[model samples]
Target chain A: MSTVVVLAPIIVANWPVITAVVGAAVGSLGFAVVRGEETSQQRGETTTREEIEIDNSEILTSDTGFEEEIVVQREGVRAIFSRDARGVLRVCMEGRGTSHAELRRWGQELIDRVTQQYAYHRIVTELKARNMTIVDEQVEEDHTVKIRVRSW
Target chain B: MAKEELEIEISPSGKVTARTLGVKGPRCLELADLLARIVGREESRTLTHEYYETERQVTDQVDLYGHR
Candidate 1:
């Protein structure tokens, strides 16, 4: 390594990526998205279908001034997405039915995925703005990204 | 050929690590600095054997060109 550096990621929340990750996380845990109309219609229906649901509108709110919270539910895990006063997006996993360690793992995984996507886009955009040619880029299996660029 | 190259790795946790290739001498740090600014704030930096080796090559080239 000619030079090695460590840095704290500057969080510029990419709302699209966050929304996608929320869908992914919920899907991976065997939850289905419930649209507002469907949720209301199914209130009295006896259904055997598994329905771990989240409101799509709440996840895609355009308002960025105040805090927004979206809750995604699984069988026993509740994933909460909220923005703090400082504009920091947070993912919290909580439920009394599951192990605390398991919830923490899920929460951390969501955070890592969001941060990785945000950094990837930010770095690529900045590199282009600086007129550097991106030689190659790849996302590793560990969810890390490697980019090689050439600059005169 | 553009003899300056930068490789950056961003960890899942949002930490960034960058290295310079094909750049010699103090120029290595200069390239790194540019990349660091683009990526994020630098937490720590370590210069490798390649860095020192490139520095020596730059010095040799300067001496050769200067004398001629």
Candidate 2:
């Protein structure tokens, strides 16, 4: 490679885009999405639970639509993905019987998957807009994408 | 007749590297800029011998120590 670069992901997307990517990432990582379920005790019972939620709408403004929360569970790890008022997606990972490092690693993997999917779509669209023809595309064993294009 | 080719590698971690083939001089920079804009920010670039090859020269010696 003549020029090599490292890209730090800049999370900028609306709720729909974020939700699509989050679903894809969740599937790729073997996590099953569970719909809304009660996290508190019923019938006026006083039971304390340490359930962690991933809602960051408290700091959002009025422009961004009402926040939607998604919960995915796998093994002892739970990941909550949501979008804030400013249209930024955030993922919060909590583990019930796992170590802190394991939780962080899982969170990183989710982020990487989402970023890769997003970047692939964005790059293809932008390059096509610049009038470049895609000659070939390959996905490596590690899931990285290599694309060959011709400008003229 | 040879055609200009740009090989773009997007890592799983979202890094991008573009290698230009059959393009020389300032045109290489243009290709790199195009790829960078499509990918993300420009981190660093290393100029190859082909990068130094001019449109008016016929040199074939490989120079491998150019970086910026």
Candidate 3:
């Protein structure tokens, strides 16, 4: 990827889920974010959209306002943290039946529980992480990924 | 006897790679800003060579608050 690394998609456990069909159509929910971005979606149809599921939702349930359609079958996967081209900092998971060793075991248990829960602060002790690899495995298709990071 | 090297890589499809060793430049964005606040959201960012030898950029881009 070239540029576009300021994103968020962390939907823990799973909220009420469709809570009354997206809270009564979430007032014709419009995409707060647009332009080629979506993960974990398997309830597809109505036109064209593969997947993209990032929760902690804003309570918007598509009526085709912001082009909404996010579902990971049963929300078994959700993760997004990117920046490649050697810049490092990677955490990417594609959804839609979420598989690929269970999204690489939930992206390696969310980076070892977010690096020991933020290892005593100080911006994570200045970028110190090492241990992980499985860059390719496309269980047929729709579940893609590529990972690697290193420094000093 | 040298120790203080970090390298984290988690791929298979869910991506995340953090590599830091002996620390560098103002702690390299304090180590890539605490792993960009733990995969909450960060699509892109670049700075190495110990993140240009960061003197200070403490990492502050909050405003995600409740994560809506």
DockQ of predictions, in order shown? 0.54, 0.41, 0.11
lDDT-better candidate, 2 vs 3: 2
DockQ of 3: 0.11
| Highest-scoring model, TM-score | 2
User: Model 1, A1-152: lDDT tens per residue?
Assistant: 57666665655444555655555545534543333232212355432222222211123345545325556666645566665545457665655555667767766665665555556666778878888889998878876789998888
Q: Give the TM-score of candidate 1.
A: 0.65
Per residue, candidate 2 scores C-alpha lDDT tens digits across B1-68 of 45778777777766666778777787888877765655556777887777665843533333322321
DockQ-based class of model 3 = incorrect
Residue lDDT tens for model 2, A1-152 = 33434444344555656666667667768887777653223334443223222222122333456447677777756677765555456676766566667777788777677677766776778878888789999988888789888877
Interface RMSD of each: 2.0, 2.3, 12.6
- Predicted complex 2: CAPRI docking category: acceptable
Off by over 4 Å in 1: A13-78, A94-96, B52-68
Error of 1 at B1 (Å): 4.9
lDDT string for model 1 (B1-68, tens) is 64678888888776777878876667778776765665556788888887798668778999999999
Residue range B17-61, candidate 3, lDDT tens digits: 555555646555554565667554556655555444333443322
